[model samples]
Target: MEIGFPNHPRRNLLKEIEWIGKNGFDFVDLFLEEDMATPEKVDVNKTRELLEKYDLGIVGHTAWYMPIGSPVKALRSACIAELKRYFRTFAELGVEYVNIHANWPGGLFTDKEGVKFQIETLKKLVEEAKEFGIKLMLEPLDTRFDTVKNISSILKAIPELYLHLDIGHTSLYGRKPEDFIKKFHARLKHVHLHDNNKSRDLHLPLGCGSIEWEKILKLLKKYYDGTITLEVFSRDRDYVLLARDKLIELWNKL
Candidate 1:
């Protein structure tokens, strides 16, 4: 199991990279959220140098603000453009997977329409990605305010697109993460392995939440051929360390 941490751009990325290397991590996911600045601001050449220096594999988390399913054609086009830019950066950095969220509902499209749009959008993105030799992994968000609520929905729409299964989101939505692995096992490309209480989308460390970590890890070992990213995020260093240690333990069990 190749372990990695999420990219919180608010933190000094180089420092974080050094810290991750010191702590024995081998990969990092560069998360691109709206409030966070673009990856362009960070010296890509220097970032790549550091990653190579630390021997860390990079993965990209695409932007969260743009709505790919927007009802307005202009908005959707803009979203696609921004996504392409992110994808381009991922390709340039030699990142393996570019993680994307499914289009939210009530944007420019209904749930069904959003799924259709997302599939179409993915087709275009996949074509573009092939040029860069990058793979796109579409993730299923929990039902909270998110547009894409379930794995089944995304699979039904575009069975061929790579999947990034977020176990914490699955548990929050009262769905079994194993179900996804069993059903979409072949399409799985990466994972966001975190835990949450039964109530919310809390990115808790392993074993602290209601998830069956043993069962999940067993299934992951059986079915997944991709990296397992521990997606715990918080300002507290102790929480991060505890979660990281627990995740390593779970990986050992596998």
Candidate 2:
């Protein structure tokens, strides 16, 4: 399995790339978002050069704030257009998979209506992404949509859409990571690993929370052998490094 690190939108993308490379990560989950790392602001050619220099692979990540599942057709179309812009940047970077969050607009629609909106938007995205040589994956946030049954329904609606499973998110709302692995392992193409307190998505380092890392790793090994990003969000770089080491150690033991 290839391991990766994500660039925080608050930091310089080029420097983030260098740090991931120097730290021995196999790839970078390039999150093209605001405050710094927007597609218009990022230098794709230069970023590609640095990835080549480090021999690192890339997976595209979009900002979670986008209202892709907005019930309004015009607003949803605008969101899809914005996604295409990111697709162009990711395509230039040779990214194989790009992830979008399942950000359903609350109080604007019923649960059923929201799913319909999301599925419609995803269908267009999946087809358009192919033109750019990229496959789109749906990332579930901390909401009802993150449940196995709910996610499965969306996956059924769009067979081309892949799953971006975040272990940290799964730990919330009385959800078990194993349920996601067992149910959607076949659909999973990329993974995000971080620890949380089971009540909140703190993005803590592995073993520093309520998650059972050893068990999760064992199940993951049996089903997933693809790209995994250490999505830890600690201020100290040492915690990220430590999480990576701990993950490797756990995977080896299993």
Query: Largest lDDT belongs to which candidate?
Result: 2
- Candidate 2 residues 144-208, lDDT tens each? 66777777778899999999999999889999889988988999999999998899889999999
- Tens-place lDDT per residue, model 1, 182-207, is 87778888898777896688887777
Error of 1 at 53 (Å): 1.5
Give the least accurate 10-residue stretch of model 1, judged by summed lDDT: 143-152
State the displacement of the C-alpha of residue 96, model 1, in Å, after optimal TM-score superposition.
2.5
The best candidate in terms of TM-score: 2
lDDT of each: 0.73, 0.89
TM-score of each: 0.89, 0.97
| Model 1 pairs in collision | 70-108, 71-108, 104-147
In every candidate, how many clashes are there? Answer: 3, 0
What residue pairs clash in candidate 2, if any at all?
none
- Ten residues in sequence with the least summed lDDT for candidate 2: 103-112
